[model samples]
Target: MMGWLWAVQVILFAAGTGLGMSDARRKSTEVRLPLWVRMLISLTLTAAAFALWRDDPASSSKEWIFWGMAWSFIGDLSMAGIIPWRHPMIGGMLTFAVAHVFYIAAFAAALHHEGLDLMNAGLAVVAVFYGLVLIAAWLLLIRNPDAPRLFNIGSLVYGLWIGAMASAAAAMAWSLGGALWLTAVGGLLFVVSDTIIGAAAIGGRLLRHQGYWVWLTYVAAQMCIVYAFTL
Candidate 1:
C-alpha cells in the first residue's frame, strides 16, 4: 500500500508540474484554470506522500516531515489566491519558514542517527562559499528599490532561514558520505526556487514566468526529501 501510494504521489506531482508549465505559457491570456488545477493536484500529492509513511517506523522523524509537508500545503494555498494582499507572499514565506524548521529538525535527527562528522575541511569550504552566495543574494534583495521596504526585510529574513536549512542538508550529506545527496540537492533547488520567486516579485520582468521553474524545483525538492527517508 505504501509503495503504491508513493507511486501515485509522484505521478500527481509530475502531472501538476507539467500543468504548471502550461499555465506559465498561457498566463498572459488571463486563463488561470490550469494554475488552479495544478495547485489542487499538488496539494493532493503532498497529502498522499504524507499518508504513505504515517504509520511507519522512525515515528519522530516522520512526524516532523509530515508537519513540514502540512505547512508546505498551507503555503501552497496561501500562494494560490489571486489577491496578493489577501494571501501575501510574506505569509507564504512564513508558512514555508516553519516547514523548513521542521525539515531541519528531521534532517538533524537523521544526521544524528548516521553519526555526523563535520570536521572535514572540504565541507567547511563549501559551506562558507554557499553562505557567501546567500549573503550576496540577500543584499541584492535588500537594495532593490522597486520592492516595498517590508517585503525586502521579510524576504531577507526568510532567505536566511531557508539558506540555513539548505546548509544543514548539505552538512548531513557530507556526514553521511553522500547518502543524502538528494536532500542536499533538493535544499539547493528550494533556495533557487525561492530566489527566482522573490526576484520576480520585486519587479524583475525577465523572471515573469518564474512560477513554472519555481514550482518545478519546489515540488521536486519536496519529493526528493520524501525519497531520502527510504535511502
Candidate 2:
C-alpha cells in the first residue's frame, strides 16, 4: 500500500507537470495557484510517504528523499505561480537549490565512517567542472541582451548546486564502493533540463522546432531525476 502511495504521488506529479506544460503552451505565463494551497497539498502527500517508511528505519535515505520531493513540489509550484505581492522569483530556485543540498547530505550520511581523501579530491574535480560549465552557459546566454539576466543567474546557481550534489554522491560511492551511479546520472539530467530551459530562453526562436525538443528534454530530465532519487 505504501509503495502504491509513492506510485500515486508520481502519477500526480506527472499529471501536474503535463497540465502545467499544456498551460504554458496555451498561455505564455503559468496560471497562478495559491502558494499555501500548493504547500498544503505537498505536505499532506509527504506525510503519507513518510508514514510508509516508518517501518524500515534503516532506509534513512528515503527520509532525505521524501523531504527533497516535498521541497521540489513547493519549488515547482512557486515557479509556476506569480505572486501579487512583490517577491523575488529567484527564491524558488534558491529553495530548490537548498533541497539539492539536502540530497547531498543524505548521500554523505550514507557513508560508513570513510576517510575523506578520495571524497575531497572528487569534490574538487566536480567543483572545477561546475565552474567551467557555468562559464560556458553564461558566455552563450549573455551574448543576447534580451536574454533574462535572472534566468542566466538562476541557471548558474542551479547547475552549481546540482553539480555539487552529484559530486558528493560520486564521492560517497567511491569511498563506500556502492552502486550509487544514479546520483551521477541525476546530476547529468539536471544539466540536461537547465540546458533545454536556457536554449528556450536564448536561441529558441532561432532553433527550428525548439518547443518539441524543449518539452521532451525537460520531461526526460525530470523523470530521470525522480527515479534517481528513488534509487
Candidate 3:
C-alpha cells in the first residue's frame, strides 16, 4: 500500500510539473487554467509522502521532514494566492524559511541517529565551501535595489538557513561514507533551485523557461529528500 501511494504521488507530481511548465510557456498573460490545480497536486504529493513515512520506527527525523513538507505546501499556496500584502513575496519567503528550518532540523536528527562525526575534516571542508557560496548569495541579493528591502533581507536569512541545511546533509553523507547520497543530492538540488529563484526575483530577469526549470528541480529535490529516509 505504501509503495502504491508513493507511486501515485510520483505520478501526480509529474502531472503537476507538466501542467505548470505548460502554463509557464504560454505567451498569454491571462492564464487559461488556474494555478491552484498544480498547487493542489503538489500539496497532495507531500501529504502522501508524509502518510507513507508517518509510521517509521527508525527515527523522529521522518516527522520533521513531514513538517517541512507541510510548510512547503503552505508556502506554495501563499505564493499562488493573490494577497494584498505590502511586500507580496514576504508571505512565501517566510513560509519557506520555516520549511527550511524544519528540513535543517530533520537532517540534524538524522545525523544524530547515525552517530556521524561532525568534526570530520571532510565535513569541515563542506562547511567552508557552502559558507562561501552563502556569502556570495547574500552579497548578490543585498545589492539588488530592484528587490524590496524587506524581501532582500528575508531572502538573505532564508538563503543562510537553506545553505546550512545543504551543508548538514553533505556533512552527514560524507561522515557516513557515501551511503546517504539521496540527502546530499537533494540538498544540493534544493539549493540550486532556490538560487535560480532568488536570482530571477532579484534581478528581474527571466531566463528561458525559467519557471519550468525551477519547478522541475524543486519537485525532484523534495521527492529525493522524502526518499532518503527509505534508505
- Cα lDDT of model 3 overall? 0.71
Between candidates 2 and 3, the one scoring higher on TM-score is: 3
lDDT of 3 by residue, 175-199 (tens): 7645467887888888888877877
Residue 204 of model 1, lDDT score:
62
Q: Model 3 shows how many backbone clashes?
A: 0
Clashes of 1: 0
- Pick by lDDT: 1 or 3, better one: 3
> Candidate 1, residues 106-154: lDDT per residue as tens digits?
7777766656544455346656866787778766643476677878788
Best by TM-score: 3
Which runs of model 3 end up more than 4 angstroms from their true locations? 17-34, 82-86, 117-120, 137-142, 177-179
lDDT of 2 by residue, 38-123 (tens): 34445545565356346456666656766666676666566556433233346566767877866676666666434344356766
Ranking by lDDT: 3, 1, 2
- All models: lDDT? 0.71, 0.57, 0.71
